[model samples]
Target: DVKVTQSSRYLVKRTGEKVFLECVQDMDHENMFWYRQDPGLGLRLIYFSYDVKMKEKGDIPEGYSVSREKKERFSLILESASTNQTSMYLCASSFGGRPGYTFGSGTRLTVV
Candidate 1:
């Protein structure tokens, strides 16, 4: 079974700090994604990579960026964290065209 691991479960940061959220998958999935869960907006995709060294921006990619240097690792970067960016961040991995995905236990971030 595929297991997605997130580096941190909770995070607190100041208004202008740069935050790095890491996700790793045990299965060599071809697709990896980063999404933020907000109350009203639901789960909005921030970034995704289909293969190593390749990425495509999702609906809400303005305040974020992603790196997929290795097949099992994907990293999400917040250039400068802000209060509005505070939310539950989820990482997921799946085989392309597969029916289901494996997700990490999310990282809840708060910016003061």
Candidate 2:
């Protein structure tokens, strides 16, 4: 099994609905992040947490929120799903300020 796991591999949501993407890490990493990938836009950071209950906004945090109530769990919340938000979401974790991240198999979300 992968060290980092995302709750869903694929999801479909209606516009204006709330959506939650869950990710869990088994390695006890100190940093966890959420990113969205598009056809040519590449990976854009949406949110991140360095420790439990601590979160920071990343490059594309607008329309997205995050929760890190526990060390092993990090959740990304889309308050209102939109077609513009449809993309592949990635969850990653790292420890000791390492440059590399262990990523979960991405979640493909489609908003209609």
Candidate 3:
């Protein structure tokens, strides 16, 4: 089974602070994604990478960025976090053109 691990389960930061979230996958999947889940907005894609050194902007790419230096690892960066950005962040990995994805446990971020 594919396992996605998030570095942090919970995070609390003040407004205007920079934050970094890391994710690692056991499977060598080609596609990795970062999503921010809100109550009504559902899961909104922030960023995704198909291969190492290649990335694409998703539905909600503003104020966020991603990196995929290795096939099994991906990182999400919040450039100067804000209060409205506080939400549950999810990381997912899957083979390209697959049906479903293996999701991480999620990291709940709170900006005060």
Candidate 4:
């Protein structure tokens, strides 16, 4: 079972509210990243994990946080979302020792 699941396909939130994005992988992967996709910015890494319970900040970590309490579950949190945070959020699990990743369908967030 090699699947990466994202909790939502479309989400709408207001500025200054907290938001949560959930992801799960059934492949037992040890590494993955939360990326935000914008038209011009492309894919920007928000957070990444080395393994369970351990994480590292990526390119854009100022407004986001991640939780990897379990091997299969990872959560992205937006403490105080702003309008600029509106974008597609993707969760991808890396293949062990390989330079590949299995990506989720992505959650399109609209923060207004």
Scored by lDDT, the top model is: 2
Tens-place lDDT per residue, model 3, 6-92, is 999999999899899999999888999999999988999999988998999999999988888899989999889999899999999
lDDT-based ranking, best first? 2, 1, 4, 3
**TM-score for model 3?**
0.96
**lDDT digits (tens) for residues 3-102 of candidate 4:** 9999999999999999999999999888988999999889999999979999999999998999999989999999999998999999999866877889
Measured with C-alpha atoms, the lDDT of residue 55 in candidate 1 is 98
Q: Mark the 10 consecutive residues where model 4 has the least summed lDDT.
A: 93-102
**Candidate 1, 1-112: lDDT as tens digits:** 6589999999999988999999999998999999999998899989999999999999999989898999999999999999999999999999998857789999999999
**What's the CA error at residue 2 for candidate 1, in Å?**
3.1
lDDT of each prediction vs. the true structure? 0.94, 0.95, 0.93, 0.94
Worst 10 residues of 3 by lDDT: 64-73
Runs in model 1 lying further than 4 Å from the true structure: none
Candidate number with the higher TM-score (2 or 3):
2
For candidate 1, the per-residue lDDT at 35 reads: 93
lDDT per residue as tens, model 2, 3-81: 9999999999999999999999999899999999999899999999999999999999999999999999999999999
Report the alpha-carbon TM-score of model 1 versus the true structure.
0.96
> Where is model 2 more than 4 Å wrong at Cα?
none
Per-candidate TM-score against the hidden true structure: 0.96, 0.97, 0.96, 0.96
